[model samples]
Target: MPVWPFKRSKADIDAKRLLEAVTQTSRQPALFGEGRIPDTLEGRFELMALNASLALIRLREAQGVESLAQAFTDKLFRLWDAGLREDGVGDLVVPKRMRKLAASFYGRLSAYGEALTSPEALATVIARNVFAAEAHAFAPALAAYAARTAETQAGGELDALFTSEGWPAYQG
Candidate 1:
């Protein structure tokens, strides 16, 4: 059988769907405002990173889904690359920016993964990363939301986790 250039692998398709779900959840209007996540680009990226990290954490835990998790991460970075180019980032600087973004994302993933076991730590992480402050009034609520989301994903079916409506509703 000949390979079709346009044909995507199953992992790719699943990853795309998962990424879409994550993006949709992160972009929810209720997640942003004066008392919630900020409405700035940094805030948006932070929210996206947070959601993606949660998905990745679940994927990593699921049996025989390592490839899917890797694909999801690859597709996410690719989207970020395209977005950067679309935003007028020159080719010369794209790599540098991507590196920075990757470092930030990985750092968050580590911090969040470690902090997830503790509510206070999670709240502190959210306040520092999402709100860019030492302690934000909404950090506890956001942390609670993250905890609830993590629990939902942990108990959800893998197939359902990749769907657009897979994530729990954000009441923030």
Candidate 2:
């Protein structure tokens, strides 16, 4: 079993919806008429984290690391909880259920320490180091959560949810 609550189930319809939701929500307004939605810091994090976890799962599997994928997810979820505790915003920032999904993704990525030092991480690295990396990897997932939130609060006006510069900032 995973150290976290990220159950080891095969990807399904829900996962597909979740992934699509992440992409739709993470999209920035068309950049310079390029029709390219800029990947916000949050979005970047989610993509990186998810991709890294996938990579780690592959690597571990190739090396015969038993249940490594499960372990990775568990660590990510644990770290996510820790990050929330350090910031004291678990309840404030995300709902309980969605938080689990986000945390599970985050936990999975965080498990790949060696991968963090690689060029891919370098390409994905933004402002901060470890913290930035972790946050960036979870950006898309967070965006999905935010999209869901916008839906609940304002019927999913995602464009309004994002800032003119691209991503939203904490008012406080």
Candidate 3:
């Protein structure tokens, strides 16, 4: 008997929702509008990190639901790993890539987590990571977007997420 997609486990359903939300958050046009965020690999990675940090932080705060968050993060990393392989990263260097990616994720997560607290902090972190201190041109817009997104994510419910089957409408 073939398994029906709608009959998936709660874990599977939640993972799908989380992935969709993350991708949608990353693609929010306000992010790239007027070049606030680059439309390149580095820019994409930074945007994903920002969204993941928000999701992970919220999940951690929800009592008894942290494991689900870990599962979601694991799935995202797995997708990244597969992408690396598809892009011609050798098997031998895959482990190294994983390590590098993990480090980058954690570092950005930490920076972004702190950055979300205030516009000043957000600007500093954004300048360091996204612009490499070259400029703070987009930091203000990016900070506003993060603040808005963080507010939206704050009201999301972990349990309800399993049944929420669509991509999020990101507001910048």
Give lDDT per model, in order.
0.89, 0.40, 0.74
TM-score of 1: 0.93
Measured against the true structure, the TM-scores of the candidates, in listed sequence, are 0.93, 0.30, 0.83
Looking at model 3, residue 137 earns an lDDT score of 80
* lDDT for each residue of candidate 1 in 10-71, tens digit (9 for 90 to 100): 98899999999999888889989888877987788999999999998888788988889999
Of candidate 1, the 10-residue stretch with the lowest lDDT total is 163-172
List, residue by residue over 12-31, the lDDT tens digit for candidate 2: 33233333333343343331
Cα RMSD to native, each candidate?
2.0, 18.3, 3.4
Write candidate 3's Cα lDDT for 27-110 as tens digits. 777677455788877788788877777678777767876557877888889978887898789999998988998998999888
Candidate 1 residue runs with Cα over 4 Å from true position: 1-6
Q: Model 1: which residue pairs collide?
A: none
Please report, as a residue range, the 10-residue window in candidate 3 with the lowest summed lDDT. Answer: 160-169
Q: Where in model 2 is the C-alpha error above 4 Å? A: 1-41, 60-63, 90-172
Q: Clashing residue pairs, candidate 3?
A: none
| Model 2 alpha-carbon miss at residue 47, Å | 3.7
Error of 2 at 103 (Å): 8.9
> How many clashes (backbone N, Cα, C below 3 Å) per candidate?
0, 13, 0
Reference-based lDDT, residue 127, model 1? 91
